[model samples]
Target chain A: MTGYTAKKAGYAIEYIALIAVVLIVWCVMAGRGTLNEIIMPAPSKVLDTVTELIGSGVLWTNLVISVVRVLKGYFIAVVLGVSLGILIGLSKHAERLSVLIIQIIKPIPPIAWIPLVILWFGIGESGKVFLIFLGSFFNILINVHDGIKQADEKYIEVSKSMETPFFKHIFRLIIPGAAPNIFTGLRIGLSSGWMCVVAAELVSSTTGLGYMIMNARQFGQTDVVIVGMLTIGIIGKLMDSLLRAVEKRAIKWNWSE
Target chain B: MEHKYIEIKGLSKIFTRKKESVHALENIDFSVDRGELVCILGPSGCGKSTLLRAICGLDTEHSGDVFIDGRKVIKPEKTRGMVFQEHRLFPWLTVEENVAFALNGVDKDTKAELVQQHIDLVGLTGFEKSYPRQLSGGMAQRAGIARALVNDPELLLLDEPFGALDTFTKMAMQKELKQIRKKSNTTMIMVTHDIDEAVFLADRIIVMSPRPGSIVKVIDVDLAEPRDRNSYEFLEIRKEVFNEF
Candidate 1:
């Protein structure tokens, strides 16, 4: 469970220096009273706001809502994307037909769908999730397609020599071979999912970390905005680390072998 | 009047890459009797591996016929199991799982029993749960052999099975292969560039030369079983096979 436990002195120095620089800038600005309070709240004030939100159970509720929204969208995107991606990757006809459509739709930013999503689903949880799904689905699809397409021809020949059927070859050989790429797709999908959640909440939601930040901005509660932003960054980092741990166990052979 | 277990007549292969054509094999012909162990000996790029692929039905883009028993080989069948130069054991699967890979439709009890038996045959009984990455080069090749044998194939095709191993390990593996062949008595055809290996294991060695590879000689090893490297007969056969180079 202890991952990357060997700490290098150079890396440690870099991390400490980064934090020290941020702290010095914050302290100098607060002490000199150069920036207005509404624009750049004191770090201490932001920390105090975080504790207050935690004590009142507000932060927990927003965090859960945002997490639930992201999970819903991400799960749906993975299931549909992986299935269709495999289909399109294996079949020449499917690739020919879908490549143009996928290319046209994939490059459009997830936030650009906000107007349509809101118009179709209203400002409910479904609309927010739809936006997030749009954010993640295409990236996951493309990665999975590439993964299946790029499976080692040698392994495929192994399956062929075994008289393995097409479906069996795909499930037994291709999917597993494509796993490393699929994991990469999942990680990218997650960050994109998070981005969509915040963007969607910014425009229409009333009860997420993004909504909290936007709502606090209206009330000139700059400390609360900083707290919300910091919470998002911390959560994203934690999720990525957790994913890295799982990936290490799953693809350990890739490293040592 | 005599039955040939495997028959190849006028087999030829030409590959095209980037609008350039290269002849891999030309007008090759050979046959092996049932239960015989044969080795195709050649230098690198001499079409020995290509011949094995054609026999195993992995490459059909050739001009000729390969008959296993009385039937023309068309597509790959479970009857012909193959092991590549590298221990192509799937990284995701454990040793046991890799051996059981071909027994997809078998009953669970039968599958486990067969897997265990083959694992034991390859001297990997204790490492069944280990992944291919955890194994040594020889151990992984043993696992590959076990995987190929788990299906009880009529013919086991090996493409330079010990080419990647260190000298000592390769010698040890060659000895174990003899024992395995004696125990199972399954027909096998191995491709190799090593003349010593060809003399050590083959009942008959088909010597080939490169550049549109064609057979130059077919040397039958008449040495006794448990072949000794220092024996006069062994040296004579080795010298004879090397002379074809």
Candidate 2:
């Protein structure tokens, strides 16, 4: 246990070391006026902008708005994607009917939908949520379908021999068996949703970190732009870590084996 | 004529892939008396596992009839339980949960009791909470057996239950299986490629040949309890079964 902890601490030190080096270089360059403040503000300037945003409640308000939008889209994607996946997975007819349509729509990037989204929903939250939904839905659907298909036939045979009830068979055997893959889809779908929300906000939204970054760019507040980018990176990482933690707990058997 | 506990008649299976048909089993017929332990011994690709699957109703594509307690088997039922070559335990479930998997309609206490009883029967008492990955191959197979027996099935079908184990573990498991059979008196039909395993556990051994698998011989083992593998009688029976191959 001690050795494991020491190894983990070593990795943490390495991660922080690289970031510290980059920050020191940036600070030195900006202090020496080698870098223009408009283009690349000093770390201190960005820190001040962060503090100012926080004091004025702009950071928290926009952060809440972005998070709520992501949650709405992600929730919808998960519900529809997993249900549709299960439907297609269990029925040969459903799979055959939907495969071609899903394939055609899946390849078109979520970014490509921005023009149509604007034409339909304008710059409202609905369009942004729809864009995020599109980004995440297919990833989850495809993965869940694959996961169900890949469940071992042997286990199914055992379930059959036991005469497990139809609903019980699906819930106890098939779902748990496909859980690892479903979790993979969920994690990937979440990240994709995060990316799409930012892109949508960038293209048309009046709020969110993406809009904050764009608005700062126009006003030449490079410090605020830098802060917005940093916020997105940190929050994205945090969300991923949260999901990973849940995945680790829920499927401990996968890790041990 | 006395009604057999289990019966198979004119069982045949053919697999067609891309217009090429492979005959797996041809005119296979057999039966097991109540509380009797029968082993179907054969070489690989001899349809021993296929026959076991057909008996358990896991393979209903076969053109034939299987009757257990005078009832035709159209699909798998709780009255018949099966253990496969691999343990096939649910990776997500603990030993206790896997044992209790097929059990429903019973009260929670009864369910727990049955799960506990079967776990102890298989000598997996302490590892009830442990997942399949945490157990060794033999232990996992033991859990599989417990799960199969939890339903208290009248007939237990095992297709190479210990085939994946090392020689020592296989021998030990065979002994445990014998003890289990003695205690439960459940009708067991085991399919095995190992000659010694058949000799060790089976009351009657049905030997088969590959390439349209057909029963070549049926040899009854009348050895006394705690039969010695190295004894002359055991060797004689082993030799007789081996010669048929």
- Tell me each candidate's TM-score: 0.94, 0.93
Considering only N, C-alpha and C atoms within 3 Å, which residue pairs clash in candidate 2?
none
lDDT of 2 by residue, A10-105 (tens): 999998999999999999998899998788888888898899999999988888888888889999999999999988988899999999999999
* Displacement of the residue B132 alpha carbon in candidate 1, Å: 0.6
True contacts kept of each: 0.57, 0.88
Model 1 RMSD, rounded to 1 decimal: 2.6
For lDDT, the strongest prediction is: 2
Top-TM-score structure, candidate number: 1
Worst 10 residues of 1 chain B by lDDT: B97-106
Candidate 1 lDDT, tens digit per residue, A145-250? 9999998988777777777767777787899889898888888888788877788796578899889888998999989888888888888878778887788888
lDDT of 2 at A32: 94
lDDT of 2 at A255: 89
